[model samples]
Target: MLLLVHAALTFMLVGLILMVQWVHYPLFAQVGAATWPAYEREHQNRITFLVGPLMLAELLSAAWLTLHPPPALPSWSVWLGLVLTLLIWVSTALVQSPLHGRLSAAFDARLHRQLVVGNWFRTLVWLLRGGLCLWWLTLLL
Candidate 1:
């Protein structure tokens, strides 16, 4: 049950990250400078609403799975998932949040580009995590 929930959350996060990396972040520059601050603020707020609970759930589920992995799933895979989750959290705090903060104050093209590029780290991590989940799911069959 725990493994299933973890897999589902990770998969959902991967989908969200892909959209943010490819669609949402790139479009930030298209917003007019005068309205960019308000737009960015609203974006941040709305995204938090969507991402916050899922992130927390993912983190908790990853921790649980790490501590008590299912019999068929390898321990190393669970550890890797936990590590990926940590990297995602660290990247959000150190890289993405700062970029969002800067954009919230005022739109900067360079910062916008950095946000889009740096987001790939999270995107890739989530993708890897999702793959790990799928592998574990396959083991169940």
Candidate 2:
């Protein structure tokens, strides 16, 4: 049940990131310079509300599962999952969050591009984590 919850959170992030990557972030450049700052701030606030809880739940659950994995799941896999979850947090705090901060101040073309490109790291990590979760869930069945 815990693993199912973890997988559900991870898959939700996977879908969210894919939409942000392909749809949301790309549209930033089109929002117009005059309104970009306010738009960027609103995006930060709204997205944080949606993404923040899911991330925290996934992170805590990943840590718990790492220490007490299902009998069918290998210890190393849970460890990897935890590490990947940590990477997502680290990347958010260190990279993506700062870029959002800069964009909120004023939209820079270079920074907008960086936000779009740098986001690929988190997107890909979630994709990998989602696949791993599905594979691990299969082992239980």
Candidate 3:
């Protein structure tokens, strides 16, 4: 049951990250300079509300799975999931959050490009976690 929930949450994150990476980030420049700071602030606040719980759940669940990995599962899978989860968290804190902070202060074209590019790492990480969860689910079944 826990694994199922984890998989569902991971899939949601994967979808959201893809949306943010390809669609949302690209549109930031169009927000225009006068309102960009406010727009970015709202984005940070609102997106936190949207993704925070999901990410927390994912992290907790990944930890849980790591500690109580299934009997049939290959040992490395759970460890890999936990590692991927940590990578996402670390990347968000170290790379993406700072980029967002910079953009929130004011839109810089160079920084905007960096955000989009840096976000690709997180997006790919989420996708890998999604695949790992899917594999675990299949193994459980």
Give me the candidate number with maximum lDDT.
Answer: 2
lDDT of each structure?
0.93, 0.94, 0.92
What TM-score does candidate 2 reach? 0.98
Off by over 4 Å in 2: none
Over 4 Å off, model 1: none
**Tens digits of per-residue lDDT for model 3 on 1-141?**
888999999999999999999999999989999999999999999999999999999999989988998798888989999999999999999998988987888899999999999899999889988888888888888
- Best first by lDDT, ranked: 2, 1, 3
Candidate 3 has its poorest 10 consecutive residues by lDDT at 132-141
Worst 10 residues of 1 by lDDT: 97-106
lDDT per residue (tens digit) for residues 1-141 in model 1: 998899999989999999999899999889999999899999999999999999999999999999998899989999999999999999999999988998899999999989999999899999999999999999998
Distance (Å) between predicted and true CA of 88, model 3?
0.3
Clashing pairs in 3: none
Q: Cα deviation of 134 in candidate 2 (Å)?
A: 0.4
TM-score of each: 0.98, 0.98, 0.98
Give per-residue CA lDDT, model 2, range 47-114, as digits (tens).
99999999999999999999899999989999999999999999999999999998888889999899
